[model samples]
Target: RRRTRLERSWRDCQRLWKWVSKKWLEKHRDVHNLKTIWFLRHPFKIRSGGEHKCFFCAYATKKWEENIGNRPPRTEKWTRCDYCPGRLVDSKFHCINAQYHYFNHPDLFCKEIERLNILRLRQETVGRSQGRPHA
Candidate 1:
């Protein structure tokens, strides 16, 4: 139905993402009418608590522990809802990093990874998958 670009054309064009959606932005926009915005990094950033900041990989990772905190050690791996976006050098990488973390656990997590792999495959086969650059 829609020609899927890696992301929306406008977002890719402006390099605009880490989206603060319009409804929220509209509330803040009235503060000063928001002057000529040039390049903006993700205005919101996560701060690590206590000792460690975050794990960094050659790829990126997102804030994983925030979601499923201290579970009973999953029998399957779970990706964050936001992880479909994958890693970038700048900010957002935890989605993949948590994935990698889970990927290491052969006991329970790996099996879950396998299921997700199957789901990805099914979506791709049916042409229902969305948003990825050509590899």
Candidate 2:
């Protein structure tokens, strides 16, 4: 029984580590490289998302299509994923994930936008032959 408990705890740590690793890789793609954002609770907004069943924000992405402030979200306020037990801080990690890769690869980001089924968002990104702006 003790072994089983330890194994479960180890698995929990591994899951958190995986999330952090994903964020690190995302940072390499994004600029802030450290910023994190909250997750939009609407399952529609989240791909491969599960029922966290809470409020969400619809801010804008790039082209000015779907976003937190722009997109319509549920009104019922609930605790964010970060506050949930064993729930890694998806917001900050997510915020960094979004902004980092946004402009550098608009095409890929655009593809993601389509995946999200939101309208095209305008992303003025650098990192190509264009001068990388000091943001």
Candidate 3:
């Protein structure tokens, strides 16, 4: 019979958590930003063909209807792979504002994450205090 045992100290756990969190944030920072925006009810708008510029890529999807006849409405949502680190494809690249490259732009995503975290923490603190009985 053989037995194997492993033990990790508190410091080891903390270090592992820190490393995991850093890697996770690096990968899904944009996802966090997206969630935060959803929580804050911040709208990510898609502009009209003749009017607004795309939020990502910062390019205008010109009025293609004039060139061709009426086509199916754009139902595809943009994914991170579409544009970030490399441009995958460029088709109907609609978006909200100029911050389309949120996945690549950690600075922009981090700022938004910080702002939303502040708001969420403030709300949680107030809620917790309010629920407690007077002492």
CA lDDT of each candidate? 0.31, 0.30, 0.34
User: Tens-digit lDDT track for model 1 on 1-135?
Assistant: 564432332133222211212322345432112211312333322233211211121101233454466434654324433323233211333423554343232222223333444554455555644664332
Residue pairs clashing in model 1 are 60-93, 61-93, 61-94, 62-93, 62-94, 62-95, 75-108
Indicate which candidate wins on lDDT: 3
Ranking by lDDT: 3, 1, 2
All candidates: CA RMSD (Å): 15.6, 18.2, 19.1
Off by over 4 Å in 2: 1-3, 28-135
Ten consecutive residues with minimal summed lDDT in candidate 3?
3-12
TM of each candidate vs. truth:
0.25, 0.20, 0.26
Worst 10 residues of 1 by lDDT: 50-59
Residue-wise lDDT of candidate 3 within 39-80, one digit each (tens)?
Answer: 245343434321211222221132232323444345332333
Better of 2 and 3 by lDDT: 3
Residue lDDT tens for model 2, 1-135: 243322333233233333434555566544223223222211133221123211111111111232335433554212232322122222232221455333354334333323332210112133333675321
lDDT of 2 at 31: 23
Question: How many clashes show up in model 1?
Answer: 7
Query: Candidate 3, 104: how far from true, in Å?
Result: 4.2
